[model samples]
Target: MDTLGALALATEPPTDNLMKRNPVGRREPLVTNIMWRNLFVQALYQVAILLIFDFDGVRILRLQNESRSNAEKVTNTFIFNTFVFCQWSICSSII
Candidate 1:
């Protein structure tokens, strides 16, 4: 080959060698999948919070009114109060 032809050949990357050495195709990154999973988990967490704050609160209040004994009423109130306190603490800590 001439000097210029030899120089060009030397500078050019060998496509055949590259293709043979790395046969695997490019793959999608894991970040998108991980982000979607995190969003799903967060949505489930919000649903759980709604169930606890709304449905459970209503049920507890109803039960409190139905109970005849003072002891049972006090126990139910205490449990509800504790739940509220814990929920508040969690919110405050997160903020």
Candidate 2:
């Protein structure tokens, strides 16, 4: 047989045992739990930071001031709030 054929023949098909041997799958349950706990904690931290930085009285006042009329101001505020919510959702998914 050619070298390529010989090499191909030497490789065995994957099995459950092979999957079990993977380094990623060998982590302890405690390690996996800790990783998940950290991820949730970080996500909460990011949410808190975003809330602190993005939603302020000054920003609301600026939005209110930019509109020409009461109806326009309400519409503008609704759009701005929707945009902020969408941004937060995207950021949370990314993080």
Model 2: per-residue Cα lDDT over 20-49, one tens digit each: 884755445745777788778867866675
RMSD for each of the candidates: 20.1, 13.3
List where candidate 1 sits over 4 angstroms from the true fold.
1-31, 59-95
The top-ranked prediction according to lDDT is 1
TM-score of each: 0.31, 0.30
CA-lDDT, candidates in order: 0.61, 0.59
The clash count for each model shown is: 0, 0
Tens-digit lDDT string for candidate 1 (2-74): 4555576588877877768955556856468877896687667766765565546545555555545764555
